[model samples]
Target: MTPTSLELSTLGHRIRHQRVSHGLTLDELGERVGVAGSQLSLIENGKREPKLSLLQAIAAETGVQVTDLLSTEPPNRRAALEIELERAQHGSVFRQLGIAPVKVTKSMTDETIESLLGLHRELQRREREAIATPEEARRANTELRLKMRDVDNYLGDIEKLAEKQLKSAGHVSGALTHRTVSIMAEQLGFELIYVSDLPHSARSVTDLENGRIYLPPASIPGGHGLRSMALQAMAHRLLGHQRPTDYADFLQQRLEINYFAAACLMPETASVAFLAQAKKDRNLAVEDFRDAFGTTHESAGMRLTNLATRHLDIPLHFLRVDGSGAITRVYENDGLPLPMDVTGAVDGQIACRKWSARSAFDEQNRTTEHYQYTDTPAGTFWCSTQTGTTAEGEFSITVGVPFDDAKWFRGRETQKRATSTCPDESCCRRPSTDLAERWTGKAWPSARVHMQMFSPLPRGVFPGVDDNEVYEFLDRHM
Candidate 1:
């Protein structure tokens, strides 16, 4: 096989080392090997590849095997350091910094090279830590969402795995029962153990050695929350996940496990069948799907994004916005105009106040879903939003489709309509002319800054998880 650049560099170092050790000058070695001294210098400096015949001559003259001259191992510690420095200088990070490459010479001490390598390593560590920042995390999330949108957010392998597991548990199903969830866990060699004391940062913890899945004793009403947590824990094992090495890895693993859990909770075969029938009846609604599967409105809405485009040929969008109008989660393939930052990230950006997701928070009768037809710059889209509360705060879950596709949904005839000029400063970001004149320069309101804006992601083998707390909890349980 052709050697890599680094391997060839090491080979050159080995050849040079062997030649020097044998007390041969470059000119003498070049004459012995039937090559010019200039060419031999180039080979020794790793700038040229030597022929096998020339290598054999050098190996014979130097009293070493041909393999010795071709060995990838650096001949000495200094040579290894030099190779490392060269490799680091050639790296993208170093190149992006626009710094000139440091040239190593015989006069440069080994200590100086070690110091430079240490700085390079530190730079790499800092760069990795910077990726944990919220802006960087959002950028990564945005990219992942676009990729999911391209594939209609479907994972056939994961869907099949959920189906096989459900089949193994004898779940033919309306709503997946708690007992069935336990049976699935047991089949995977795990026992469901409910406990009062779980780590504050963790939802569920799995003891691989003891085959125990520890869960919170008190689950949310209707048991859907408990089932989801249990399924997510089992999914880590099912998906063969390793400890995340970085923020992006952590985000990916989190998405995969959640997808696995949703797939199990709302089995693909059953969900598609139910949706196909609903579309046939022209009664497609997120609440009906939620009730049918016994899942949260947000879960059902997201699950629809997974199936709607691929199975029903209907593109759509999903959104979860906090009461303050900031988007918490979003996915779109229907060309809805959602707010975004310069990085193309929608997370934490404020949704247009005129959109149903934000307006639903003000509805007097929030017991039912709010439906609206919004005319955006892109097109007119119909959305159904349901408002709910959690420990964190009030939020809205919405599922929407283009105006053309709204005919297949239940709330298509709703007379409520709105017009949004979003992404424009005048839309919702700016106050009315009179109000702006009245409040401008007179208001010095203190902004409520979220801690996440300034802080990096939690540091650990698992981000945001306290290892010591988990270990203590596990010890107490044992």
Candidate 2:
């Protein structure tokens, strides 16, 4: 530990007293300050000396001042250390959240510190980016959620087939969920804490104190939509969560993604290809949409929402549940009537109540109810809509295109749901079993594997070698 320059006075007494006032046990304080209980006990008992760094950490955690820890000198200096410590910790947390820091190094001179203070505005700008673009830094969010759902299903099978109930984890049930969320959270260098008081019926919570993310599973009318919805919820976690502060901008991003994903999967060429092969399709049947676009039903629905808005010829809006259970949709045709604020039982918000009304996979009892549409001063948005599912429904993807399209349904109806086909080398879903099979009985060549590896290994092929080819030649000959 780096030592601090804090002086000894009545500071040790003040530190121990402040720890108690803050409701932290000696061990708790020790953990926060990077001290052991025995060491803390000695410091508190005045049997051992106190270091400035320990005092700084304590003041930071307890909101006490280093000066207060020192002599009760001036009232202004009394809590200075605590304030500085807090400032440092907050910067660290923001960095954890993918925001840039105002300034990293310590500055002893007032002028240098003022220069650092000027960097605060830059920090704010970075924070704004993080808040505005939850979609950024989210390459695998959609895929990760889908894979986790598969993992969850695999776990469910194990849980069901086991002769005896697995030991109940009680409060630690969240631990099981944490394991799934942790992989991403760790990549982001964040800590996920389970908070019971989360505002919505989210599958998990994030930033309970500063940022609240809720994941509500979507419920389709019949049992048909449950698997898709559950998977969607997990995907929603990858998007990360926060209540949209700017609804219009947020909605715009939603619209853009809906459109982009659709365009990527069903380019004008692909659309033309479908038109040439089959004519007079209508309803944009989910299965047909998936196959036509080479994407999952959920992805197809997302594309439909954006595509319809962009082409007007398609004129459709769609809602689909991904593997994680989030009910995401892309909407088109602004003039149409739909309820925007049909949130929950609570007035004026997004909702998850319909899905919660029944178990996810209950197909027989699944049924559609009247959808509520609310007209807004700006336009129309969906209030609520319900659909039914078949008892043995496979994962369903639903697409709703305008009736004006000549062959929407016929082209869409006979199609089948498609599996994900996007290729990302770092994909967590790489077919390990397939790779193992492909390599069985074959001695994989190292040179071929090296060609596929990420370029610029940790060091050049050989350190201090200006030319890699030269080094390779020497290695081969020597």
Candidate 3:
């Protein structure tokens, strides 16, 4: 990697930390420094560089002087070597010298180094455009999320369309019932099937011409994943989405479909009213709301974010993390800064062990709720999380609000706090010096697949379904 690119990540990380430390949202900081909030967001994410004047203003406002922002020590031997290899890939000098650069991060486990090297090779050739690695995909997605800043992460048009459709389906103004879901499907000319042998490539599928939808058996072990999958299939037909041209549009489209599916499952009017009542009762636990709506924890958590940002005006963030500690999905609307990797947003990157989502993996029961406070360079955020295990793997669903806003929710009472400065050296870059002195080449030997970090999240063509399988199934149906 070029030093400039590396500097971008480092600079963004520090400035974001400083901004959050000052308890200033991007909008507030932008107002203070006279830059657009969207531009500030990109600068904070390391995707954009600030002008000299803007940099001066940022230094004055955030107290992170220019030198500190620009200064990033060269990467450790491992990362430095990787960069040198990338730089020499086409260099005539390296070609003459035969200076083969081995792909590895000396500090990380061998497996991770391999996975990253694999990703680097995959994207090393093609010209960059939206889709390359999971990180690039997330960067594109984050940019889309940032665009919604003006609308507070609420796509009002999509939400309004969903409500109007729900009303026409006779769910005019109440909680959506499974019976009502069945009714809506029939009204849309779809026949729903609960199948025991549906291929594993998808959670659900639809045969539009045949007017049939397929779902896994209800007895399947795991979170209520099938519910959302089935609804998403229904949504594809209802929303009339054209084929997406690229991953960014694909991701953006799925988010809209998810909004539609959630509206159908939780129905905005009643869900909002119920949440309002729950807020009054100081019982905003997501589990209770999931139970109340008979939805899965993931769906419940997503709906909570929607309600918080769009309806309640509560400003919140949501995280869906794998048991392995990778952030599978993130929705950040609350102004708290999220740390991103050199590749992109936190997606597919390992979360700090100190994060609530990471801790949720340790819960005894697969479904018990976890509540905790996480203190980051940004600010403290109170979070409620729960685990859900499926055939795919166990993952955590977490919803958090900034510390200042936590008082309105029930989980604010958590005394446990985790300190984190992620994507930073102190977080996980090196072995603990004291612990290392004792073990020092004695017992640290393990290598699991951090492969999730390098894999692309297959979305768009079908949310959870593999795109190839979707095409095959549709072909067979026709």
Candidate 4:
């Protein structure tokens, strides 16, 4: 490109000054800017009007701006970039000189900008190659597994994250979905395999066709049901390539799906048979039950909790409560409908009331409404359950065990505050007796266990559940 006489001279002079200021020898500047030292000298001396584009090239190479080359006011547009490059160059000089290059600054000169752009492109290229490489893929898988393990460690953290997300949107992040979960899983190393069958033989399976992973759903008997839908939703979350964001939606889906998964792990028929055999001798103990089924305590409790639903005589839900009296997990077996969010209410405090059972069938049926004080080797624990429902007709049944039981899963000192003891010295429950330890190693039936825990409807919290109204709302869209 041609240059105006003034612009050329202006550009040449800027280029010369920038080159010298940046501490670049003529040969170094020439090599960097794609111009020979002799040619550059001629241009600097105003013997020739270099191509306008050449001025851009020199500006870029020297970390100066094109406007700087063409302007006469002070340093021009390129001066800032040149100054930055000079600082960087000066730092390198200091480093070579055995001095600390402590106060370094960044430059945005043409050459530096070009170098940055080139570096970005190069990094992108390398990333593409890394993704395609088997070794890199394996490394990615290892990293993903490590992350998943960490995720398992902070399930409480996950619950908190979910709760925060739910309170924000009444759902998780919209971007969190099955696809994202699957992608994350693959990156973490576990393969996601999707299947269409209730109680699928495998929760996850490898897909040889595409050499990818699959997380299949537990099938429904007839291949249709809300439960199936929930399972599929969870599959999308857990096995798919997306991380789901809707905490409430995710919980609704995950619990329903995994309830079936845990159910299918030891199918209902088998569980019933085993429980029947155990009942013949005695109520199944926790360790014996876990050993017989080779399952976690929570898993075992869930299976047992499912019992009350099928048999009315055993109307109960089992939960592991923390010192703060928060129910971390709930398992339902005896009752068709149990109170929902039982976990949320008793989450971080001791339930110091007798177990109160409520039902959708009878809102005021109070069974075992009195707390029985008990003592045991471990300590005293107040345990109870009450039934209530949100205005939406979502039921919640809650039961609490001692916070010390948490040690079964985690080896840690039991916090006294969880047993209803006050944190402050002036509090009433101070020096409170250990309710759980008071009754430890006892063979009390569910009803006879001594602790004060109950669930009643939250005064103002209501969830809506009117199928007809829901249908009507949908009809409006139709």
**The 10-residue segment with the lowest total lDDT in model 4:** 456-465
TM-score, ranked from best to worst: 1, 3, 2, 4
- Which of 2 and 3 is the better model by lDDT? 3
* Residue 280 local lDDT, model 1: 99
TM-score for candidate 1, please give it: 0.76
Q: Per-residue alpha-carbon lDDT of model 2 for 1-478, expressed as tens digits?
A: 5223232223445666688778988898898788898888777544566777877887789886766666643123323443343354356434676755443233455555545545654655444434422232122233333343233212222222111111221211211233333333343444443333333322333333333333323332332223222223333343453443333334433433333323323443345445444434333344454565345545545544433433334444444433333343323343332223222111111212222211222334333222222222333333222343335332223343332442434432222221222123222235478786888678656553423134331122112223434334334422
Candidate 2 CA-lDDT value = 0.39
Q: Which residue pairs collide, candidate 1?
A: none
What lDDT does candidate 1 reach at residue 23? 89
Q: Per model, state how many residue pairs clash.
A: 0, 43, 0, 91
Candidate order by decreasing lDDT: 1, 3, 4, 2
Better model by TM-score, 1 or 2? 1
TM of each candidate vs. truth:
0.76, 0.28, 0.64, 0.28
lDDT of the candidates, in the order given: 0.90, 0.39, 0.72, 0.42
Task: Supply candidate 4's per-residue lDDT for 168.
Answer: 39
After superposing all C-alphas onto the true structure, candidate 2 shows an RMSD in angstroms of 24.7
State the weakest 10-residue window (summed lDDT) of model 1. 125-134
Better of 2 and 4 by lDDT: 4
